[model samples]
Target: MDVDNTKPKPDTVTLRWSYSPITYFEGPFRFKENNCCWEFFDGSATATINAKYPVNKSQIKNDLNKRIESIFNASLIYNHTPYKVSEPFMEGYDSKGNLWITPVPINLNLSVSGPNIVIKDSNGNAIEDMKGNRLRDIEEFAKLSIKYSGDPAAQAILRNYKSAVGEPNSEFCHFYAIREVLTTRFWSATKVRSCLNLKKDDWTKLGKLCNEIPVQQGRHQGQKYEQFRKATNVELEEARIIVKTMVKQFFNYLQNSESH
Candidate 1:
C-alpha cells in the first residue's frame, strides 16, 4: 500500500513529572522559556513546548531535566533541604486527536507527610515559619535565583550551594565558596553584615569557623591530615546557620535592588 507523506504534524508537546519533597506555593508558579511554558505546583510540574515542526523527544527530555534540576537546586539553597523530581513522561496529540506517548520511565516515591514548606498565598500574607525564616521568604529567594539564572555569578552561587548541601563533610568549604563568589560580585563584608544584621565579631567568627580553623570541614586544603580535627556537630550547625543566613540576605538584597 502507498501512503501520503504530506500530512502536517503536531506543533506542541507536554511533559509531566512528579517531584519531592512536596512543596506548596500560593498558587501555580509559571514561567516562559524560548518556546516553552513551565508550570510548577505542589508535587508535580508540566512543561508545554511549542515547535514549528516535529522535534526530537529525547532532546526535549534532556533539556527539561536540566531545567528542573536547576530550579530544585535553587530550592535547596532556600529551603536548606533537598528537592527531587522523577523522570519526565512526555505526551502529545495529533491534529486528529491521536495520542502519542514517549515512554519515559518514572519512579515516584513521594512522602506522605505534609508539605516540606508552605509559601505565601497570592496576596503575600505570611505563612508559618520554617527554620526561623518564613516559608514565603524561601519562595522569594528561589524566585530571585530563577530571575538571575542567566547571571554567571548567580550560577556559581547556586552551584556552590548545591555542593554544600550534598557534601556534609566539606560543607564549610562549599559554603565559603558561595561567600567568595558574592564578594567577587561586589558584595563587601560590610554590606553582607549590614544586610544580615550581623555584628562584626559574629562575621569574623563565621570566617574563622569556615576558613581559619584547621578542621576537616574547613577550607584549608593544604593542611596535613594529622593537623586537622573533625568539626563538632555544634560547630557545623553554627556555620551552616551563618552561611545560610548570608545567602538569604544576599538574595533579599538583590530582590529589593531590582525593584527600585
Candidate 2:
C-alpha cells in the first residue's frame, strides 16, 4: 500500500450560524458556485462535523475550531459580543492580528432597533447635537425642542417624561409623544390655551386630535380596541409633524409668557 501524506482530507464538516436571537441553522454549508470552499449554511454554524479524509481531518477541524474560538476571544477582549443580541454585532480586527467583534458595524448605518437607536453620518461617527452627542431615539426631537424652544420644561413635556400604566415614559413613539404633549398640563388645558393665546377653533382641533387616541379599556364607536395595535406609520408621521409644530408654538408662548 502506498501512503499519501501530502493529500488534503475529504471530510464532512458541519457548521452553525445564527444572526437572529431565536433562529439558527446547523448543517453542512451549501456549495457556492463562485467560491469552492465547503462551508456552513448561510449565516449559521454546525454543531459538529464528521467525515472521512485521506489526511488528518481531526487536525484540520481542530485548527478551524481554534480560529473561531480566537475570534470570539478577541471579541471579549475588545468588549464585542459575538452573538446576535439586542445590541448589534459585527466582525472586526485588532492591532494584535486577531479577528475581533464590535457591537456596532464597521460600516456606518442608521438603524433604529426597538429601544436602541444608532445614527451614523456618512463617515460612521455619532451625530452631535443637544442630546449629549450619543445616538438615541427622539434625538431629532430633542435637538429641535432645544434649538427652537430653549425651555427644559417644554423639552420634558416633549419627552413625555412621566410614566403611566401601559405607557412608556420615553417619547420614542410619535403617537405616544403626541398624546403626552396634547394632554399634559402646562397648568391645565384651559390655561395652556390661554397662555398660548390659541383661538377656540384651534383649541378644539387640538382637543379632537388628542381624543383620536383609541380608548384603552373599552369599545369605542362600538368597536373593540386592541391593546397590541398602534397607529399606522403614516398616521404616526402626520401626527409627529403636527405635534412638532405645536411644540414649537407652545415653546414660543412659554418664552414670551411675561410679555404676553
Candidate 3:
C-alpha cells in the first residue's frame, strides 16, 4: 500500500471506450472522448468482445498485458524520461533511490472477475473494471478531442493533452515491441536562411521585418518581395510569428478532425 503520493498527476488521459468500428477505431476496442458509459447513445463505451469475437479468458489476459506494455514502455520517453515497466498488477515503490520527478513504476496485470476485465495499479490496486480490453482501447476521448476539435480554444485543449501524455494511441503506443513513435526550433535569423537556402546572417534587413510585424495582425506577408532574400529584418520576424501562428492553428485543426 506504499503508493508514491508525491508524484505529479499532470492531468492524465481523460478518455472513453468502445467496441464498434467507427471513426478512428476499427479494432475490438477503442478509447473516445465525451463518451458516456451508458449504452443509450451512439458513441458510448462497450465490452471489447461481443458474442461475435469472444476470446478465451487466458487469451484476453495476455492481450491485456501486451496492451499495457504498449501504453507505458521502458524504452520510450515521456517528458524526456522512459516509462518504467513494473511487475504485474502489484504496486511498485521507488525504494531508497527514488527520485522526486520520476513517475511511480507502472503495473502490467489484468484479470477477470464476474463479467469485467480488471486492470490493477502497481500496488495491487484495482484501477478499472473494463471487459478485458482496457489498455488496447483507443483512449477515445483523447482521440476524439484531437480529431474533432476545430476551434482555437478546443485545439488548444488537445495540445495540452499531447504535452501531458505522449499520444496514448501513438504507434509504438499502438504497434511492434508495442507501439510506434510520433519539436519546433530555430531562431528568427536562422529561420530566414533555411527558407531561402541562403547562408545564416546573410541579410540584416529580414531580421528587422520579422521583428516589425506585430503578432496581432494575423497575416503573413512572406511573398511581398520577389525573392526570399528581399525580405528585411522586421518583415522576417513579422512574417515568422504571423506565419507560425497560422500554421500552428491549421495543423491543430487537422489533428482534431482526423479521428472521425
Best prediction by lDDT: 1
Candidate 1: regions farther than 4 A off? 1-12, 18-45, 48-63, 82-86, 106-135, 191-199, 221-227
Would you list the C-alpha lDDT of every candidate in the order shown? 0.69, 0.37, 0.30
| Rank order (by lDDT, best first) | 1, 2, 3
Error of 1 at 131 (Å): 10
Distance (Å) between predicted and true CA of 28, model 2? 49
Query: What C-alpha lDDT, on a 0 to 100 scale, does residue 60 get in candidate 3?
Result: 39
Q: Which residue pairs does candidate 2 place in steric collision?
A: 15-45, 15-46, 16-44, 16-45, 16-46, 17-44, 17-45, 29-39, 29-40
Q: Candidate 1's residue-wise lDDT over 65-89, tens digit each?
A: 7766666776675556655678888
For model 2, residues 109-222, the per-residue Cα lDDT tens digits are 222222223467999987654222222222223233434333445645433422211242112233344435545646466766576655556555434433444533111323
Judged by lDDT relative to the true structure, which candidate is superior, 1 or 3? 1
What TM-score against the true fold does each predicted structure earn? Answer: 0.68, 0.31, 0.20
Write model 3 residue lDDT over 74-140, tens digit each, in one string. Answer: 1122111222223322111233323222232333332212234478999998887553333233243
RMSD of each: 8.3, 19.5, 20.3
| Order of candidate numbers by TM-score, starting with the best | 1, 2, 3
> Over 4 Å off in model 2, which ranges?
1-107, 110-152, 161-185, 199-223, 226-238, 258-260
